[model samples]
Target: MENKNRLLLYVHFNRNNQLSEHVLYQLQQLRHNFEEIYLISNSKLTDGDFVRLTDSKLADGFLQRENVGYDFAAWAEAMKHYGFDKLANYDSVTIMNDTCFGPVYDFSKTIEQMESDNQIDFWGITNNRSHKVKPWEDKEAIVLTDHIQSYFVSYKQKVVQSTTFQKFWSGIEILDDVVAVIIKYETAMTKYFEDAGFKSAVLFDTRKEDWTGMVVHDFSVFNLPELLRRKIPLLKIKAFSYGAEYLTTPLVVEQLKASTLYPIRLLIDHMTDVDYPDRAYMLGEKTLTFNHENTSNNLLKIAIHLHANHLEPIPEYFEYFNKYVQDYELYITTDSQEKKAAIEQTYPVSQLKSVILTESDEILSWWDVATKMEQYDLVGHFCTQRNEDKNWLFEEVQQREIKQVLLKPAQEIFQTFKEDSKLGLLVTDVPTFYQQFKTENLTADEIWGNMAQIWQKIEFRKDRDLKRLSNKSLKYATMVWYRPQALYNLLKIDIKKLAIDSGVLIDEFFPAFERLLIYVSWTSGYDFRVSPSLPKERLVLEQSDNQVPQVLGVDFEQIRLRKLLKELLRKVKKIITYRFKLKK
Candidate 1:
């Protein structure tokens, strides 16, 4: 059999305008089947990335254009650049995009299988069935037609040579709306070619399969595990981000690791560009103990910043640190000379770097010391003020939470950072005190309150999705173990000036700033993990009803019944009012 001359046009886009390792890996895998590969990037490449892409020699041709009209526009631009006559010379041309992760298995096998079929004019890795209403359409009454998913579609020589294909490419308008582009191109392209007498086939015929009760109509993302099991070449990138609600991304990640020789780091690097809520779940490693027997050899340049506003907890704090931490440069920030003297007395002045007196609150003090922190590789921040308002049990939980990161698992935490360069922040999991009142959405007002104006001062990454910031599992008391690089954006801000401009109280500023730290770390291209204070079973035991105390002369059981009766009466009143309004 004569080998066909295959060409691949791969569309690439990155918010940072840099080529990712995953794309390069995909191109490397695709080289087996395609004689020539062209990379079309919508995002203008950075000089470094441009050099990297060109130096790799993965693509025969490269096109960088204005990022408009999404992937379809990029494909159209590539087709126009090549000209129809030149494109027709190839036996087959495959148009694919960087929206997917793989070519997990060998691409040549899939290409061979598709090429063997003589009847099909064009083919795609997967296809969608005609549905009542399009996923994005609610009021438009649009019925999505059965079509080959545009992410990965290959056209035979006959289709490429045909006027219909040429006309379709020429007629594409650069639309601003994503849905408009999808309706005009992606969902319509297959039907347009078919109507012009091009017979289309798909590797996975989703029309015959039952997708009943599925979260989405796009099977590429929702049914990725099954597709991988059946030897599908690509995995949609959305599976890790928005698609997580419908499917378990960690399971799919594990499957890829076990089944294929694909580099998992490529996936992790790519995830930094998107809003992945499961960063902790996916990248976080629980540190039980330092793997090394001699932990002294691997000791990092550690800085422990203790905001000792209250002098009483100074002894307890130092005692905890003395017990677990082997070595660290201690920097204490105290408000009053009296408190500084007390802290100095509690911990030896020889061991301490300095006891700086600052009028600014905890967050401001941390920011003031940000310059000093940059010198250290790992920085741990804690405040004695966190224990002030809490009751005995709550205080104990808070202390344990802080100890989890800085004391009990201190060595393992250090080891985890040393081993994983990408691991930025290790925060204590939602403290038991806050767990009882956990809400999925913590409003900006609720979190920042009067200090909300501080957001304007902080320079956040433009590429980051600000919406995801609101939904993050926040570190309430802002106790954290982090790499200095993780808080680069936050640390760069002139926080003193910000406090002056915003007129937010120094005491209230820290809590508000704490809310934004997780987001800042994420935008800085770092991953964070939640370190649980205690084991799950132990936490359950601590949170049990037996731990609660009954107030003297107060009948809690009677009060509970009264609350239930009030709720029932309110519901009955609402029902009566609703029925009366309906009758009226």
Candidate 2:
């Protein structure tokens, strides 16, 4: 089935902990099954002692991360080196972790089955079942959705050689740009395969396992390891050895063995999400969805936008949108009035409510709206996530840690400001990131979206008996700046004038930067991290337990980046005044 016999069994073994020993036993036992076992290690793969590891009857060569550390994540930098290790010589690349395994039988047969099916994107496995299946729960098995952290994966040589790989977790700088980068590349790859009319997730693997995961949570009748032991005796039954054998009692084993392809069927099910999905769906691109699920959950529906065209794309896109959304109540919190009004006119606004001030609210945050708003869901423009190597922001500011550092101040500033302060407006020297949230419109059930999901459940739980979402971690971000540079220094930097300036344009970079984080719109309080759309009045109210105006914070680092951004407004003023005076 595969064009080549050299199956590159890729695993990045870290001598770091419990996982390493398990991986070693796995490699030593399975190396004979593969032609030449190759490994990429975070450990010292080349050290003389480690070199001895290569002498093993199983491992032929070893690749190490440190050899290729190009100042990015250990993973991203390692790819180029490992590409040298075996990917070049190999045509069919099967990528999987030790945790990700299937039938022990001929790996060649498995490749044959995959290719005979004509799925070059057959990156994951699926369970072939005889019984009826649950439709919605597919992703619980194996999701290729939000982000693919390597657990188990397989790819063709083309996927590995052709695409530029990136990896990132939930946080990174300039997320939109990072996300745009990831989407742009992945979409391109997926489209290339797609235009040929084969389904692929760009560089992402769209193939789903039958049950999505091997460890099915009682919900899926996905039988246990006991059921598997007979079918796959070399099964190294992890579930049972770890005291989980009860999941596969005799009856389930009998049912599983009944299949013609005993071990393979089970493995396939474990890889694909043939069932259990929509666990938390990605937001759709469709701007408006007519709600079929209805309650008097009225507040405002904000358009959590991910992009801005320097030139207007729609003269009156909203006019078309307003006609559909007007019946249900909602508030609009975007940056453009022409856009907002055109949208408002499109939908019936008799029930529509307030619009957030385009000036004060920079359009760079979904965290704010989810925290501030009373109710919301990302209806469209759903995104896909892969590991950090494919993530975009890693392309620019390029450090994973720097993206993490920015949030500390954001959380602090939010905690300090209370809505009652009525501080008509609080200013931060930090240009784009404001820690304050205006709380005038919060409802009785609204709680800070910044709190953990458990807290949101406890705080907002209608059931008085269980204080679930409320008791979770609720932190207040306070104004940590002003003291360092003082508020006056901020005005002198010209932020106050910028805020006052009627035609002040929202910067274009905010949305472009957030995609590096696995960003989705805020629904549960626990979901707040790097925000996609800035805190719009409605989304904040939806996220808030009580609506109030509060401080927006950013590390003075942003202020520093801004000083380098452009000439100071005051400096520009002086330059213009001098030029005019000289002209006289």
Candidate 3:
């Protein structure tokens, strides 16, 4: 038997143009399998990243190209640079991408097994069966043929030296559309080589149906545990990043942690960098409860800032805090001296640290208290407002916000904060009404635009993903328990100037600020979790129900009347448009 020499070309991409730990870990594991390894990146590497790549010494060579064409383009560019004549010196060549989080087990065993089977000219880790209809194409029902998945594919010298392979690499063009690239390169490559009289095989074939009777062709996405059980080396990163319908990411994460020596933090870092919005929801501790007994105080400094515009809720709010919070300093702001006096008369004045009279709205009051935030480790903001509208939905949401934030025992919440150093903001879940109407009412372009304007004012951390920040779930009512340091950048901003010059509506500013709070915390290297009155699971189920909650006490007649008015307005607009057209 001849001594076999193998070459590996690893394709990588990072939006920040920095090399990630996972990619490095992958190369470190695979370095031994190949005689020489080359790293081909779509992103132009930063100076620091280039230095680190050179220092690692895992790759024999490196190539950086424009990020126009996905993994296939990177591979093609590598081939073009190396040339077919030079590549023919190796017995086998493996082309892999950074789209997965493995070799969960050892890479050597899988490589040995594949190398022993010399019958196949080329091979891949997985293969897809022919589809009745193409997945990406909706307008036309086109059939998709069976092909080897392009993520981790190896070619024997015969396939590599063949004119067909050389021609395929030569014909590679810059494709802007990802779907087109997938169709032309990834899906077509296997068939193209097969038509040239080359045999192909997959380590874990998806062409045959299994006992699970799972229809999903991508075993990497759905049958990950089974794949791992069968000692399939790689785990697809998309299983956790994009998420599968029936999959629970946390379970998979736990399995990976318990079973494999693979560094889990690498996966976390990659997900965070990509700005996957559900990263926290799927990976971090799900819900922090307020019902648990406080075991230790740890003496964390706490401050509560109350904007008591209306004095009606002052006494009740104080009672809730007194019962729940172990200790805290209080700051009160009122719109008038008369209202301040009334609050002082009704509530215990001795407990109040300071009572300031402010002529401006709550936004200005928030700005005035910003300087005092540094003194406290944990700070909470609450505002008292009397709803002028007799709208039941608005009242219901307001009550829910108050209950979730204030009614929960503060000692337990503080203890939770102490336990998780990274826990930045403890907020109530999105109101059921808002969640139901999120697409229609809550996620307006105006809201996102307002958030963007506010975000521009702050000196946010550079590494934070702006796209993820835009899609963050917010505490709409602006009631939250948060670490003061997490909100430092936001609190430093002069709210009065923002209110006047930003051209954002006073109402809009509050909601936008609330949304940006989560992002600010994230940028400050912190994570947030929901502390709902109900268990998060139960809350989700309740929210999913189509029936309106009885607690909302909504009047069906009012809804019907509103619907009628909308319909009437539409008819009037149509009539006006017809008359205006005739006049024109």
Candidate 4:
């Protein structure tokens, strides 16, 4: 049996006193390796809270107090409680904190590798050596003070028993200033150990000559083979946050895909969902997987309608579909014969079929081009979706959303439609976040009204098949895929009537088409489906013949207005509370 005396001191600091999923996973990894684990959290957690951790064998016990000294202070408090001298009786002392993610691959692998290197008196999973100007000092300091990153560090029995180690903890003075505490405490630990004849080492040393003088290297491109050879298991969560700013989110994801971790896609999801707020759209990264079980028999045909300007993005999508998807047909539709000829030459001649349209108008081009190419099982429609008024950052985000969310899910989306015959129209239901929805400058109810009017006008034979024609509220999205027959009523609608009205503040015609398309599907004996379900209840028509369309025509406007009023009231409450706090 392993020595019970071997202690693992884990420092945790959560401002809310609530444990997050990532933090809990980190604790579970530590418990698997170390039997005697004591937690020191910088929160005034009650006995009931400790009961959960203790019951799960996540902690032997924990110390709760006001968060004053951060992780450094927590470690010192744990040492005092355990008894400074009594800690020397342990085989080793592993000091860790909830500062990162992982033991991503396996905790046992990291432990086995670290145990092999018995000569080292102390070691860390990673080391900090980035060059930065010291706040306390005037000169730029190479932040490497021969220190191991304190996030996860282990010390041998000899070092733990040493006078230098005991005195260092005993003499630590917790300071109010965070920078001072970090400099005097965190960075000082490794140096103090080395100075007292304890050999210090790291699993993944950043100061190694292989580094190309970058302030921060992208962790997504972290060499897993090299990490396995060197025995580095954990990834710093802050590395992705740094990558999101410095290296870009896409590159971070690209590098993560190459790692040895199981379910790399889920890891990327956690990065976008849990870690980086700016990269929430990257949750669609997993949609890139091709899960069409029987692609051999059914061929997925994709067509791209290109506008006059910036048809450059068309080739990339064509190439992506050709490269990744099997048994897929590619078609490009353009008004200009010259542009069509040029695009045909760029891709493999046999694979691509170009449909040159007589009409120059964007919607007319889609109608004529799709009809000319015979009928496809699935038809994908996309507008340029560019806002010349917005900055490049916004443009990049739009392109990513289009490419990652819309284009990547093609095969799976096609399969979803093929499996269900009743499912005619498929559109991605992007949640109306205030940050995004407010930018469009169009209310949901206003869009709803425009669609309702267009649907009523377009369906001339509504009385003939009144039972089939039921209204389902649709979200405004540019990218869509649907069965060709779904647009039977839509194909009959006169293009002249869709003329932009100058009286309206917004061009309601084109925007209304997005919603009207869903109505057309319903009238043509087909049901529309949204990828993610709606956030709130709206008009949704099920595939069942007996089921009635939801009562959204009149009630939707009132529902939207009430929601707006609630939001305004919340803003007003926040403003009043801020002013009240200012008076104090």
The CA lDDT at 4 in model 2 is 45
Q: Write the per-residue lDDT of candidate 3 for residues 542-574, one digit (tens) a residue.
A: 111223222122454687799799999999999
Q: 268-292, model 4: which lDDT tens digit per residue?
A: 5345333332232232342223442
Name the weakest run of 10 consecutive residues (lDDT summed) in model 1: 540-549
Model 2 TM: 0.29
Question: What overall lDDT, based on C-alpha atoms, would model 1 receive against the true structure?
Answer: 0.73
**TM-score against native, each model:** 0.75, 0.29, 0.62, 0.49
Candidate 4 at 67: error in angstroms?
A: 2.2
Best by TM-score: 1
Candidate 2 vs 3: which has more TM-score: 3
TM-score (C-alpha) between model 4 and the true structure: 0.49
Q: Report the C-alpha displacement of residue 194, candidate 1, in angstroms.
A: 2.2
Per-candidate local distance difference test: 0.73, 0.32, 0.73, 0.59
What alpha-carbon RMSD in Å does predicted model 4 have with respect to the real structure?
A: 21.3
Clashing residue pairs found in predicted model 4: none
RMSD of each: 8.1, 26.5, 10.0, 21.3
Q: Worst ten-residue run, lDDT, model 4?
A: 543-552
Question: What is the TM-score ranking, best to worst?
Answer: 1, 3, 4, 2
